[model samples]
Target: LSTVIDGDRRMFAVTDFAGADGSAGLACDTSAAETIRAEHERTVRSHADTLDQLNTAVAIFDTDEKLRFFNQAFQKLWGLDSGFLLSAPSNTLLLDRLRSEGRIAEQPEWRRWKENLLSAYRAVESQEHWWHLPDGKTIRVVANPQPKGGVTWVFENLTEKMDLESRYQTAVRVQGETLDNLAEGVVVFGPDGRLRLSNPAFVALWGLTAEALKPNVHVSAIRDLCDQHAANSPWGGFVAAVTGFDDERRDRRGQIELINGNVLSYAVIHLPNGQVMITFVDVTDTVNVERALKDRNEALEKSDQLKNEFVQHVSYELRSPLTNIIGFTELLSLPATGPLTPKQREYVEYVGSSSSVLLTIVNDILDLATVDAGIMQLDISEMNIDRTIAAAAELVADRLDEHRIKLAIDATEAPASFHGDETRIRQILYNLLSNAANYAPEASTIRLTCRRLADAVEFSVHDDGPGMPPDVLESVFRRFEPRANGGRRRGAGLGLSIVKSFVELHGGTVRIETGQDRGTTVICTFPDKPSGIPDTPAGIRDAAE
Candidate 1:
């Protein structure tokens, strides 16, 4: 007996044992047959479970074009429910789905498959097929022959892969657009010195088109710029060295002048991917400002030389005539040289006095002119600080007496020897002492102190006079800035300003301190002498020579 089942139906075959036996009795072994039937049922159940767990859809079609079996995946792919059996002749939708999904091209592969299916061939294979699922997805498919008179097919969807590739292509296009639109001139060079890529600005700067920029462009072609400008040659060297280093990344910065007189500064960065990007910026304004400043400095120096020449010439020219005039006036003033009436004697005395005043004015004018011209050269020498202060004190002694000012000099612990311009040093002290005596009130005390500090010597003049206002104290050294109601009570403002300039020229500084009731104090510091120099009493005179 034989039994068969197709999905939902069953078939059975029974044998009559008595017909096959000749004079043999038949016995029914119900228990043994029942055990055999039970084993068979268990085997079939296990197979059905295995097929249900499969990921891919499996289907079978008989030679008669009737669908016999279909797996879970196959039914889901076709959007079909159970109880639906498909036949090759009745199901035009299957063919339509294959054609629309581009699985069966109207070419050799599809044509051959179609011929086999229409002829009801027992078994056939489909070459690289595809199908369109109900959900509008494309699935690559292939139908293979089975041992039984049927065909088994398998397919997988490829929608996500195609989408990813399409997006990738779009991203590349956008990146290219961004590079081209950049403002900086960018030129990329490949590893072999070929032009791999360049932005629009770069092309315009080099006076070349995209077609002209190629890897074959020689390094020598760009090296000529080095020989053209010596100062700018280092920039070219930087470019060549960085490019030839074969490094992952390198940078070079340089300057170049364009045909239109514009200066261009560029920075080039080399990337590991055989590319170099160069950016350029205009620097014409900076270059022009520096050049103009250099030219102006030269012009000022020349102008200063001319002014000094004029002052020296004038001083020499006037000195000779003044000497003679003063000598004649002195002779007339001498009583023994000539006897004269009272009126004549008075006139001669007047002429002598006027001549003396004129001589002093001329000398003062010459001294100031020389100082302004920077020709008042200092003669560095050694001198006694105490003696220098005494001489300065004597020079201003009469003024001090006239004002009834108490003049005190404190040089008890000053340096015994120093190297500097003695005459200029004395001049500075005399000016300070004289200014203090003249500007302070009649009963005020003027103090002059000199002391040796760590690295230098300090000289200060302190006066207990009506002090300068806060505003005037700060600018006391500025030329011609009058103090105490426009300096009506003192000498012209040039004296202190001149003192400051000459002191600074000797590498020293001056400062003033004052308040409403507190008197003004002026301090000047001079650098100390080194131990190598010898001390001499005649040091001051020798320095003057």
Candidate 2:
């Protein structure tokens, strides 16, 4: 029936009406019934609008299993058209459509699964399920039962959440495994001054049981255990750091020695998250090795000192006796002292030569001892290069003539005058010539060459004789290590050693060139202006060089 009431049009669906006496009657106002119907429609529209704005997909199915209402999110989540969604398809029909499109995972027992899912309409409580879709999406399906015999399905996408949880768990497992296999002891403490994490290595290093180092143990308790083993415990500092009471939150590293003779190196690190970590590594072997090496080095240095002192004492004692022997041999050879037979004169000559050779050996030893003591001062002066060379040759002339080896002097490239210790230069030249003459073949020519380079002077003594072997050349400059090597005779073996020492004192270098069947050449080079040696002892530096 339709009518105008209070200038407003109102309509109502009218059924058969009856009067109080069971007789046919006229229509009532029906305004109260119309008001209730209008309010119900406004409430339903408000609820539908709120549901449409939600992100979660929601669909309501009636007792007949047909979709009664759905929100906008439901359509978007399923990627379904508006026409199809508005047509109100059944829940089974929607599932089949999604399956056909490969959106949901395949079910082996499709019929049974569908029946169980549809059973939510008869259930009083809500049911939940997890759907792993073929498209790599995870959907949490909740079938919430309604009092009016329907089900409200909620599909919450949980793919990203599950992925994060899986990665976090994996990371935790990997960290645990890494710590368990490390050689270094590791322990972590929280800001509450309690232990948070510790590995087996930490327990073993501190000689504590696993039970004693369990989680949440206070730092003070661990300090007590440390004091029993370690000579100095660092736990007092650790407690302050973990409790946030330390003014400077800095990392520390140090070594700890145990009473049992073991040593450990430790490091304390502060993390940005207010956590502290302590690590320890065993260093007992390294410490022991260092101590042994130090002791051995000290013993070697003392032995060398004794050797130098012995050589100096022996040389000084022999000098006085040798001087008297040479003087008496000279007197006996002169006519004013006595006339002697040919055999007596020859014996005197032999005695004088033998005394001279002994004196030379003693003098060489004294010179070496002085150098070793770091007190040998060079008398540097300007000298004529040609005169120095001539004088050195005259000294070694008798040996060269005896061997029938000719001396060949080549000083065309030498400077007229050079600044150096003239006495040392003459001694250097004499030692070089003597070494060459000792090894030079009879009737062979020994070449002595001197050249002026850009900033230095070079002198070379070449001998035509069998050269030194590789083994002999290896220690050719060592004192007292003489090698015959087809030479005429062997003396004190200090010729090359003295040459090297004197040349170096004059700021010079010496090198040798030789090979099998090819003669040996000893070359020495001196700088133009020598860098004066320091007044202080330089024995260590000279020996090392």
Candidate 3:
């Protein structure tokens, strides 16, 4: 008898068991079909994930150039909607756009794609080309040969990359040109102690060029000299001598004696980097100037010593004779030397006057010598501007009356507070007022004005006399210069120079304005006192030069 087995769990079955009995029979193959369906779904999901992550567009095309599978990247790259089906027409759409633009550079080496499309498969390696997208973006395209008899293209946007490269090249070229054109020798070495680069000046200095500069020569060659002079240290020890590293900018300078008897000044700079850049400036001219200056200074020192001896000898010689002359003149003026005749009295008076003038000249010369020797010191103090001006004006009041000049004071409404040496300020004002009185024409109006400015007070002496010419304006403050006072009188010209020096010492300025038709004005401006300084007229400062 033959038996039937269930196929779902059957390990063995009897031969000729094809009977479809109701109790025992084979089941359908539903489990196998479900397994195969599950595998197909998993494969599709993996492919979709891979296509989504990629940056470049991917497409699988058929032999006829009809796109079979297009990823999302392809849609974004080509500005196409997902619903559009890719075909030969879509491929031709891109090609047609490229043809209309004709952007590819024209050259004899350039190949036409349409004419040799079929032969592309024979190419050994992938080919690259450039594309200018409609949106004004540049792309570098690479065509990869596919085993399936078609090509896969990938593009990398090269706009930013190309621009950066071009800029880098331009910057390097400019740096090279600037260094090469310089007269000073320049050498840049890498941290590894090799001659990385040098300028034309460096080559000229060393009698070498790019082809001649070998790798072995470096700062180490001068190690002995560097040790002797800290400044000459290859590592720039001299920078510490001149400036503190805590400061922002540091400069290191030293001199180098070359083998050929030439001396050079080397300036070594330490960059923020570990590398050091050294510049050699041929300071031959500077060295020569320094030697000359030294010689001149020695000569000046000797001359000053001689001047001191001469001053001492002259002072001794003049003092004894001056005392005798003054005593005799006074005795004669007193009518005690046996009642002198009228002519003798007049002669005695003239002698006295001449002697007094000579004394004044000697005093002026001594004062100038003291100033030149720096023996005169400034006595700073608070000064009332109006009081000083009044005192100075009083000294010249008699002269003003004698000349019949009109004198006007414009200080009643202005502030009179300032910080300066009282005596110096008075001297300055006295000199300026006296100069005006002497230079102005008879009966000319002299206006003395004082006013407060933003940070200083201005004192002015204005005259209605002839103004200065342009040529005289430039050197008016020079010592011993005479003014063209209507071609009438000449002055010693030292007054203005003294005024200028005194005013500048007190952190002030003096100015002169002169012209032919318009009269001359001498203005002196002084720094004002801070808010709470008291106003008081003090004693005058000692007069120097």
| lDDT scores in order | 0.64, 0.86, 0.66
lDDT of 1 by residue, 272-328 (tens): 666665666667788999899999978876775665467557767777777887788
- lDDT tens per residue, model 2, 1-545: 88887898776565675678685545666777888988999998999899999988999998888888898888887898888877888988998988888878889998899899888888999999999988788899999998888899999888889999999999999999999888899999888778989888888888999889887998889988888997787777777777866757889899999888889899999977678999999889999999999998788777777777887798899999989999999989888998999999999899999989989889988888878877899998888899999999999999988978899999998999888988888999999999999888998999999999999999999998899889988778877777898888887778888888888888788999998879899999998888785432323222311
| Better candidate number, 1 or 2, judged by lDDT | 2
Better of 1 and 3 by TM-score: 3
**TM-score: which candidate is best?**
2
- lDDT string for model 3 (1-545, tens) is 22235644323322333545534454443554556777988997898688768876666554555556667766676665555544444444555444555533333433455435434445556877777765666788776677767666666667788889989999999988989899898876555444556787876665454655656455443333334433333434432322233344455677876555456778867655445577888777788888899999899777766765576468557866876897789888884567888998899988986776555445544544455454555677678877888899898897799889888989866675777778878888887787788777888889999888888888899887778888888777765567765634565555776777666656677888889968889999878753332221111111211
Clashes of each: 5, 0, 2
Top of the candidates by lDDT? 2
Q: Deviation in angstroms for 341 in model 2?
A: 3.9
lDDT score, candidate 1, position 472: 73
Q: After superposition, how far is residue 95 of candidate 1 from its true place, in Å?
A: 32
Q: State candidate 1's TM-score.
A: 0.53
Q: Give candidates' CA RMSD values in order.
A: 13.2, 6.3, 8.0
Would you estimate the TM-scores of all the predictions?
0.53, 0.77, 0.64
Ten-residue region with minimum lDDT total, candidate 1: 536-545
